[model samples]
Target: MQLIIFKDYNALSQQAANEIISLVKHKPDAVLCLPSGSTPLLTCQLLVQKAKAENVDFSSCTFIGLDEWVGIPPDNEGSCAFFFRNEVFKHLHFSASHIHLFNALSENLAQECAAMDSVIFENGGIDLMLVGVGMNGHIGFNEPGISFDLYSHIAPLDETTTAVGQKYFKEATELSQGITLGLKHLLESKKVLLLANGNKKAAIIQKALEGEITNALPASIIRQHSNSIVMIDEEAAVMLT
Candidate 1:
């Protein structure tokens, strides 16, 4: 695991965005596994601005969402699909066919999972993965428990995750099932960037750093990732080193 401690969250996010921009500039065809959350929102916006100002080309880039909320429509603002579209896609010039999002509301969830898995395989896996750590140390909704080494499959979510995710939903019941890329799929990425920001994430970040490796904290599994880069602010990195 490669850890990068920054002076503050903004600087950390900017640095991350800079690196992503460099990658895209050099390899516009790279597939990027994106995350949907406040932590990556600013970074995405900055990247779009940078692209616009410098005339960077992203026409060949492919954007793949890491996860989506089950039963939530793509138009639902609370869904990851909506988040990615409004926050990143609409702002960039990426090819529409290159952008991929899993239909969590599909009646045939099994088929959707298989199709996503095949798509990832056919694309030769993700080249760059952008991720955010949850307050419960969760990544891509792979809530800790009974799943230490998993692929793109269904897994139950922890109550804490749903509760925290409710901020996007207008109703509490709207926060329930989540479809996430398994730990195995995440580890397949050639390069991984995990961001953690705010005091709200301090405890979980510390737990991921100090606590023993266990299924209870899925984010901790990144420690075993071959080329994972973890960036955090002073508050989030307080207990990391």
Candidate 2:
């Protein structure tokens, strides 16, 4: 695991984008596990700009969503699919057929979870996974106490997670659970890029990187992975030293 602290968000985003572009260039068909939410917004924009300027081809790349809020329709503005369509797919050269998204509303959630895990396993696992640490140290919707052995599954959202996520929707939305590609899958990736920013994330970031490994702080499990890069802005790294 490597921790990289940047002076600001722009620097962090650019570096992260460059790393992703490099991986894609090296392996055009690389399977990527992508994250949702505000943390990766700038990184996605930087990727769009870089791809356009460099004429990078992402048509052969495969993108898999990290997680999705249970019961949220794809058309919902706060949905993970909606975020990918607006923030990622719309900005890249990727083919629609190459994108694999989670079905949050499936009547058979267990089967859906198994299907997601099978896809990743059959595709030779993820080559790269872009992730963001939650303020409470959760990764993907895998909240505190979630077992590290689990793969893709439905996870109950922590109260803290739901409260923080409510800001993304215009109206009051009840988000009780999420379908997430688990830590086992994320750690199986050939490389993982974990991102965090803002002063609000400082203390948690410090604990996740420097503290003991524990399921209570889900992101700390990244330490067990052979190849993991943690990128944070100055404010988020304030507690590091």
Candidate 3:
């Protein structure tokens, strides 16, 4: 894993964006696996700016959402659907047609999951997947105890995950399950970019980078990824030496 520490969250994100832009320049139609939550917001902004200022084309690009909270209607303001439409796609002005998201509400959710995995495989797999390390080191809500080799599945959110996600939800009880592309899918990407920022993440970031490769800290599994890049802000990198 490659680590890059920056002065602040925004700087860390910009550096990550530049790395992605470098890849995009080489392959404009790259399939980018995007994540949600606070850490990636600035990175997305920088990415869209790169597309605009440099006239980088996103028309041929495709986006796959990392995960979605179960049971929320697509129209709900608090949904992951809402975050993608507002924070990433709308700002970047990418065609809604090329964006793919897993809807937990589909009548045949089973079929949808199977189709998504098939489509990704047919498309030469994902080029890069942007990820945010949860405070507990959970990656894509895989939580603790789950094997990283498991593919796509519906994950029952742990109490900590549900509570942390409540920052976006109205009620903690309303947040239970999440439809996440499994750790296997994340590792399948040609490259992985994991971002962490702020004082809140300092402990986990340090542990993830400096600690052992064990299931107790799921993000540490990225240590095994040949192309994984762990980007962090100053505060988050504090204990990493």
TM-score (all chains, Cα) for each model:
0.95, 0.98, 0.94
Per-residue CA lDDT of candidate 3, range 1-241, in tens?
7887888887888888887788878998888888877888888888888878988777778888888888888777668788888887776666777788888787766676777787688778899998998878898878877788877777788888887887876654488888878888877889999998888899998888788888778898888889998888888877877
Candidates 1 and 2: which is better by lDDT? 2
Candidate 3 is scored at a TM of: 0.94
| Cα lDDT computed for each candidate against the true fold | 0.83, 0.92, 0.82
Residue-by-residue lDDT tens digits, candidate 2, 1-241: 9888899999999999999999988999999888989999899999999999998899999899999999999999999999999988988968988898889989998998998888888889999999999988999999999999999999999999999999889899999999999999877899999999999999999899899899999999989988999999999988886
Per-prediction backbone clash count: 0, 0, 0
- What candidate 1 gets wrong by more than 4 Å, as runs, is none
Q: List the residue pairs that clash in candidate 1.
A: none
Candidate 1 residue 67 C-alpha distance from true site, Å: 0.6
